[model samples]
Target: MQATTPLSANSAATAPRTAQPVAARGRLITDAPTRMFHWLFALSFVGAYLTAEGERWRMLHVTLGYTMAGLLAFRVLYGLFGPRQAGLGLLWRKLGSAPAWLKSLRTAGSLTAVNWRQGQNLLMALAVVALLVMVLPLTLSGYATFNEWGVFPGEDWLAELHEFFGEAMLFVVLGHLALIGGLSVLRRKNQAAPMLTGRVDGPGPSLVPHNRRWLAALLLLAVLAYGAWEWQQSPKGLVPANAWSQVPGGEASGGDDD
Candidate 1:
């Protein structure tokens, strides 16, 4: 019988095939309630701002303002008591390392990394803190003005302060948008899409499990119901009595003949 030839390392038949690694897919990061709060908060701000000028829109404006206040309250509670990823504990921990975090940013190759591990965490914490700072003053001043809550400086002063804070908040929001755009471009990620879809591109297991979407839906429904009820009870002078009635010489016009 002929002896079988042994395969050599150089032989193609004997070489083992190398398996290619699978690419990482997107995973759920933000929860449903958090995402809902984000978009609703944005809409409430915009609605309140756009309706600020006219008496006819004041009801809508006040309703939106109250909505914002409620949203902020919910966020505070949620942050304090919510999930691990969404809780204030994480933010507090990250903030506690502020010095080190800032230092890391200054180091070489921080931003250049293909995956900036802590970038999202840092960004979210900073944004949350800044928004809370801005929104508190804006909300308080608005409420005071609407309710005539205090007699300190006077309603005029309160209104002026409200306007100032509103403008400042707008500026902060613009800055936030600019920063988000820059980071998205640098990181090659769709940062805004995460707020809408509650997911981010990355390897799993996800930081948070499946979201409590039902809670988000309930929260939204409650807010809408409250807004509608408030709309009905809101001052008619502020709520548009009639569209045509508010025209220059229409019945709703209160100007006296000169």
Candidate 2:
């Protein structure tokens, strides 16, 4: 079997890259901006989640939550207007084939007898959608909770909902990681490395030509600046005003906490 093949522009446009041995250093399959978004989003969620429990880190938590919201905004704009391969539409297209993929399973004697790769792709698509869509609810509810928006009907309901979204996102994230692990084992290659290095094991021109490192750098800088600004705006030395002694514990004091 051929280890690699030349990727012509025409075939690249026509073919669907359904999770091959996509890892290591070779031709680029992912651009810098996409990779930057992925890592920053992950870090923001993790940092926010870790600091969610107490008053001590409330400001930091709020800042991190806002960071997630901003990152989501960036992702939405980029996916809508960015490169074709990195577009959100690609995921939607994968999801569009779900009906047919599900229909194919009915003919199989056993579920495993069906196209596993196709199923994997569908699951991945679903996971991505879940993660993306959950962000809206997560950040919205988080913002409300931080403001103590409603101490009325079903007191703390918003907080509970925000927590629920966080847990749900965590579940989907774990599943995504599992899918990557399974793909790596099945393909006898480190599938996760491609995401880190934005490359795969092949010899040809990059599928995503522009690395766009400048954009990634700018994104990183923007997030950092925002975090620092939030810190400085807080009443205390570095903590946000809310956490210092404002509305209540876990509440943002004042100034662009959103």
lDDT of each residue in 81-184, candidate 1, tens digit only? 88878886777787777777667777757468423557656665777677777888888898888887765753388888999989887877777787788878
Best by TM-score: 2
TM-score of each: 0.75, 0.79
User: Which pairs of residues collide in candidate 2?
Assistant: 242-253
Each model's lDDT comes to: 0.80, 0.85
- Which stretches in model 2 have alpha-carbon errors above 4 Å? 1-25, 109-113, 237-258
Candidate 2 lDDT over 3-121, as tens digits, reads 89778999878987687774546888989988998999999888888888877788888888889889989999999999988899989999999888888888789977898888888
User: What's the lDDT for candidate 2?
Assistant: 0.85
